[model samples]
Target: MTQWVFDLGNSRMKCAPLQEDGRLGDVRALGYGDDVAGALDGAIPAAVTGEAASAVLASVASPARTAAAVDWLTRRFGCISIVRTQPTLAGVRIAYADPARLGVDRFLALLAAHARGTRAWLVVGVGTAVTIDLLDAQGRHHGGRIAPSPRLMREALQQAAAQLPAHGGDYLEFAADTRDALASGCEGAALGLIERSLAQAEQRLGERPALLLHGGGAGELASHLDHAMLAPSLVLEGVALWARLGADG
Candidate 1:
């Protein structure tokens, strides 16, 4: 029996068939602005959904947007399950007293990290925003920090300062032009935050934790951090894990 998992983020919807063994097959990504109805069209094959045993989702999008996507899924798949941030799951305990306040994506990412190993981890998600969470070998969350992504930083600069441009730039050691400067400065800020977090994590954990990077914007910053391992489908992986565990039930 096949299962479907959808990871609905701020900018895109990443969907894939969750294999019986818990691996994803043939991932499909769709970008959406304000709504996801159109993007889901024909993305999943009808035959696949017809024979599917279950469907699940992990979303960090707005409530209205989530409702729309859930509505669509229900219409096509009969029933759909959703993953939510919990205070504790699969031996992992969240730092938040109010787990619901924590983003579902972050919580799922933590679950995915813990499931992969018992080692200490610094899970960094670079997307609409950059989020860094520390997970110890014992499945304890040491809290996390969130900051504007390089793209968001550039957009903010352009929006507030009339002359700065948000697009068309490349990272450089020493920027020779305004575009390069903006790119470097914004990207540099993200890198600086991660580096500082790494140092702090080491001090707190008594050893440097393995870094796991995910999200669309991760590629731009991952090159700067040699230790980061890119896990592009982390959230979906978490969604699949949660579905398989019957936690979404």
Candidate 2:
């Protein structure tokens, strides 16, 4: 039977089939709008729901939205596994005193990063909010930092000041126009944080950790950083790994 992984975030839901080779197949995404069920029904292919498949989900959406998604998946798949943040799993250990307090999405991303190799890593997620996580060469998490993403910054500014827009503009060292200035300032803030985190991680680990960027807004920031690996399907990859490890255990 086929196994599927779903990553439900604050803004969107991403799903993909876990292939026979233990890799993820094509990923599909749907944004959450007024009608959650309708969006899912319209975006997911009929073939996926028609067959006998199992599903694993890691959701950071609201309770109401998560309940709706669980209800829908329950009707479509024979088995459903919802991912939760664990203190220790598959070698990677969580640094949070309360494991449940750490977001599952962040945990899953750490899993995917640590699975890559023993090299130290700085896993960054740029979605609704920016998350920066540090993983040592031994898969030990060293806590993380969260900040508003550039998009969220713009949106918040737009809300507070009607003159600014929530989108558009380009990142520049010194923007001449208000739109470009807004983009530059917000994106520059995120970049500065990531760079600072990288330096701090290097100091703590005594070696430069490899940078891994993931999430919807990652592309915007990838070009600014050197040797940054952009893995948009990272969370889903972690879900697949989580499922595989569970099945093995």
Candidate 3:
């Protein structure tokens, strides 16, 4: 039977065919829209051919969107499972007092980072929000912080200040125009948070933590980070690992 793993975030849906050797193959990404449903319909069949298959999902979307997507997948794939944020998974313990309150994407990303056997990590996810979670050598979460991503910051400024444009211009050291100023300010805020977190992690842990950057906005922010490693598919990778464990059990 073919196994499929999906990561459904607020802005995008990513899915892949899980190979027998536990690697993802020909991953497909679709932005949120009516076309997403149609794309999945064709993509799944093409991935698995005519074999029996099941789908595993990790989602952080609204209830309406999740329900619609699950309903569609159930009709097409027959067996479907949705993974939740547990207190602990794959040896990584969540720092949240109420673990369920934590985003599963963050939890999954931590799992992926721990799986890499890194000494310690500062997993930074830059999407609708910038989330920084610290994981220690022993796979224990040391809490995290969340801030508005650069895109959200820009949008907020545009909404709150009529003079500011929501989209335009490159990030400049000192911008002369409204557009570049907005970009610089927003992006700088994100970078500042990450930089602060890195310092705090080192101070508290007594060693520097390796940075793992992921999510759609990571590329833009990564250019400013000296040691950040791009790990765009971490959540999806974690979803696949979760599926594997479930299959074994």
Which has the greatest TM-score?
Answer: 2
Global local distance difference test of model 2: 0.91
lDDT of 2 by residue, 1-249 (tens): 888889999989898888898789888888886566777787676677644788888999999889988988888888889999899898899999999999999999999999988889999999999999999999999999999999999999999998888888999999998889999999999999999999999999999999999999999999999999999989999999999988442
| Model number with the top lDDT | 2
Query: What are the lDDT scores of the predictions, listed in order?
Result: 0.89, 0.91, 0.87
Better of 1 and 3 by lDDT: 1
Which pairs clash (backbone N, Cα, C closer than 3 Å) in model 2?
none
User: TM-score, each model?
Assistant: 0.96, 0.96, 0.94
Model 2 misses residue 216 by how many Å?
A: 0.5
- Which digits, one per residue and each the tens of the lDDT, describe model 1 over residues 1-249? 667899999889999987768788888888988758888875876777653446798899988889989988887785678898988888789999899989999999999999999999999999999999999999999999999999999889989997999897889989999999999999999999999999999999998999999999998888899878999988888888788788633
Q: Name model 3 segments beyond 4 Å from true.
A: 34-36, 46-51, 247-249
- Select the stronger candidate by TM-score from 2 and 3: 2
Candidate 2 off by > 4 Å: 247-249
The per-candidate count of clashes, in order, stands at 0, 0, 0
- Runs in model 1 deviating more than 4 A are 51-53
